[model samples]
Target chain A: MISTTNESDPNPNESTLVEASPRRAWYRVDDFLAMGLAALIIVTATVSALLVRPPNIPQLVQDHQTSKVRLQQLDPSAESFSADRKKIIKQQAEIESSIATMPLKGWLVRPGEWKDDPRAAFVKSDKSIATPLLATFGVLLTLFAAVSFVQGQSAWRFALGFCGVFGLALFSYVLAGQEVVKHYNLEYALWAVLLGLLISNTIGTPKWLSQATRTEFYIKTGLVLLGAEVLFNKLLALGLPGVFVAWVVTPIVLVSTYLFGQYVLRIPSKSLNMVISADMSVCGVSAAVATAAACRAKKEELSLAIGLSLIFTVAMMVVQPFIVRASGMGEVIGGAWMGGTIDSTGAVAAAGELVGSVAKDVAATVKMIQNILIGVIAFAVAIYWVSFVEPRDDGSKPSVMEIWHRFPKFTLGFLLVSLILSVIQSQGIEGKSLVSSIVDGTTKSVREWMFCLAFVSIGLESNFREYRKMLASGKPVILYVCGQTLNLILSFLMAWLMFSKVFPNAASELLAK
Target chain B: MRFINTGVLKFACACAVVVAVWMLVLPVVGDFPSVRQRIEGNRAAGINPTAVFYTDHPAMADIERSIAAKVNAPTGSFWQFSARRPK
Candidate 1:
């Protein structure tokens, strides 16, 4: 007995305003708090990375010597250059292997981990600065929580309570992101939720701590920042073939799955169905977040969708490469297949590279091509849910004004960031590397932190009883499995057709040295 | 117009201001080169730079080798997770 009328007001009467009040607060206090946090993170990281440093003469001389030798080794016509090049490559590999064994550093500045990557500029941090930075972040976050959440209500107790709970969530995430946990694809989202659930269900979440669990606020802010990373320009990188495989196959799978869930399966919750459909067809946890917010889905439904995705993603990441090898599929086609099907972009790259370097490049490019669809899919879902689902159930057609009112406003923020960033990149005011630097250095890191906060909040508030109720029908599971099966079949067919059939020459040329 | 809320209007205005400042103003006035200089100096000092994409890093080799070892090994493949467990 799922009621679609609830769609119009998912958290009805939760507003701080009186029921008949005409004036709505311009923005909720939570909104301001979340936005303020995002701004603080970006400004601090950007300013610090820009201003901070210490010079080392020995390291500079060694690097210079290595670069000079490497330059000579790359000379093609020189006799023995090939042998020299091989030896250099092997030596670099040995050094990288040794670095892998070093224990994870407590501070987040991963200078050792990314030191040799040529994609973006990296800066080494002065370790002395880390203590003050961490302290500043903690103080600001706690103060913001106090002002936004407690006001004059509970005083220091509320602020300190939230700090403790949030610190616990952060610790769980840190543990989950260890090398072994990451190796198994147990992402921070899963751990954040699980850890929150363990504390809440067992000891019972304290009332004061629950006061700080603002799930929607944190995620909405993160989603707005996520918009910057969804650069539309990346969609054109792999050319038409990549587009056909990612864009064409994706929408088809999404629409067909939604329809199947509605008509054939008669799934009660349309939100759960859409989340599963998008997660299966487009991307994983990120899709679930955007689609769930767009439809105003329940937290339990989102958790369910994410849970199903992770289980399948872990299985697919390992199995897809083995299947490719056994079937003798070449790197390009195999990588494309995995890229289009696997949920996580990181796992797709890992699996692709497992096949070979050529496969890894194709897979990563195809995944980026697919990632661009999140913005479009989110916008479309928001419009569709507002114009169609809510109105039809209420037995009336929504006017443009009503539809506008129903729209998730954060989505506008998401699109605006993407549009503006895309425009900036297109203008070439600076190089592509500079823009990547700004995003990776500031917005992306802030977005990850915001998402972690949101997940922690979600876990604290969520009830396992509700999750069990949602899973009771088993339709969500069935829907995800059926949708994913279709995704695999269609994505492989499209990848094969585009890369192997229609653009074989381009594929070979792209793969060639 | 009668039904429109002033709060929503204000919120919309705030969002607009934030976006305008971030996208338009930041680039013109903010110093992006300082960050680039810091990174270049770090690179020259034998520290590698951060990459946005996972494959862009030197960790890519580590990812490939570790996964390949676990995946390409003759024993304990994906079949271990089958409905009927291996003996």
Candidate 2:
């Protein structure tokens, strides 16, 4: 059906009629898969973020009335319930329950848990920070998307970077909302130049230099900063069952995602597909960074993959928790199931808590264990990239020399920070002040700020006007849908096996005995 | 028209400049005020800027209390519950 036409006055290459390849047809099947992927992302994100949240007050009151007799009956020879202990515990539980139910606004962004502080205050509660923060990210990301869309048409560089200074600025602003940043530095005034560059669309980012150095810097820095959040000790609380769920299911998801990305759509750009698929299947966005570097994907490709992943991830945050509840699953089972399955730790923990503390403990522990895997995955990806994924001579991928040529160095710094922190934590001299500061500092800011800022950078790169011009091939995106469907099935099966059957007795024992 | 574009340009430039400067000082500004502090001081956790907006929803509490009661206790792996329309 291929036909050369006199329809155009052009060069010989332009007039050549090319038949569609088998890869192209498989891509069509991929389009259907994209819609499914979108569904999975939405379901997981929605349930996790909304349905399974921290404890509320009414539920506490009901729980206090209901569980008292059974708990007392079961543990007869335990500590004689001193009247004072009973009263104090009751009071504390009631108070936390009340706080959970209370509609107090304003985030208490200080160094310690809100329960310990007496000085935290409420503000106008109009979502001034969240809206502006989201707005800022939205606006900038739109721009990044716009620009990337245009450049993406013909650009061949596998490495990419967004305006770092802008990303830093947005990060600063999010922190500022939490009071992590204040009006301390007049140095803020000079960032106008960087902002000016973003608007001007004039930063050439000479392909050679950007792909060679700056983009690598951007991804590596993001990863290292991200490393601070993966504290390994928090995971120990989940015990053995939690470990099984995380270690087993998590690797299953990663391997499944990679295999799907490689085999199904026959995605020619392995690195790009790998990053996107990993991010979706593992820990959103961060997983993308490790896998992206490992595969040496083009920057725009990484951006498109991450953007698509986030859209789905955010949706799942609110849906999966509700799904867990609606399914009539036991709390322990639901919690472990949700924890192992949901991608984001905060959202997963929130989802687990929605079912009860058992779920929360299991979910958080599993997620924490999953988080620790990022270090291993990142290191593994880097090594593979150097040794395997990049060597391209005939059937061979790019070599170590090629990877060294492209490897981002700042990740070394990230590893150093992780190593130092892990070692310091191991030293047993962990002070409350230091530990609290480290915990608060990492959790309260890094992921939220980095994501928002990075999103903003992405917006700045993408321009809506140009994205309109691309061919409407629905294939690669469809493959993602197929991959995610496989993910949901895998996640559910693993959850049922671990939570509903295989370890049900042990999980029950872990919670009860 | 030129002035509007220029003004828009200027505003964008200012934003960029401000963002640039803040980026420089960002590491130092890490969670400057800290959300956990506000929560602890208030004796209420989950009080981040965004969480403040959902002042009416304490949905996580019921779940938490139930969980705290028997999280350590053994139960069936799959929970089965039935719900009817609340009258």
For all candidates, state DockQ relative to the true structure.
Answer: 0.02, 0.05
Q: Provide the lowest-lDDT 10-residue window in model 2 chain A.
A: A12-21
Residues A1-513 of candidate 2 have per-residue lDDT tens digits of 112222221111111011111132332221222222222322332333333334453565455545454454544235653343345346545543332221111221212111111122111342234444344444334433332333332122211233343445543333333332212111111122223234424332233222212233234434554555455553444445556666676667677767776776666666666676676666555666556655555545555565565445445545766777888766676777666655544455555555655666555555556666777677776666556655556866665556655554444545655665565444432221123234332322333333333334333333333223211354446755766676667666766665545544545543552
Q: In order, what lDDT does every prediction score? A: 0.61, 0.44
Off by over 4 Å in 1: A1-23, A29-136, A139-143, A146-158, A391-394, A429-431, B1-87
Candidate 1 residue pairs in backbone clash: A115-B48, A122-B49, A122-B50
Q: Which parts of model 2 are misplaced by more than 4 Å?
A: A1-218, A393-409, A429-436, A442-455, A462-471, A500-502, A509-513, B1-87
Model number with the top lDDT = 1
- Please give, for residues A1-513, the per-residue lDDT of candidate 1 as tens digits: 121112222132132100111124544433344445555544454455434322443353354347435744365446875466446545544432322221112333211212122111122343343453365346546645554543233434445555755675556544443333344455777877766765566555666566556567667777777777778876756667678888999999999999999999999988888988998888787878888878877777777788898888878877998999899878878988997988876667766756776687677667777877999999999899888987455698989987876777677778876786687666431323233444655566556656666677677677789888888888888998899899889988887877666655555544443
TM-score of each: 0.70, 0.54
Whole-model alpha-carbon lDDT for candidate 2 = 0.44
lDDT of 1 at A357: 68
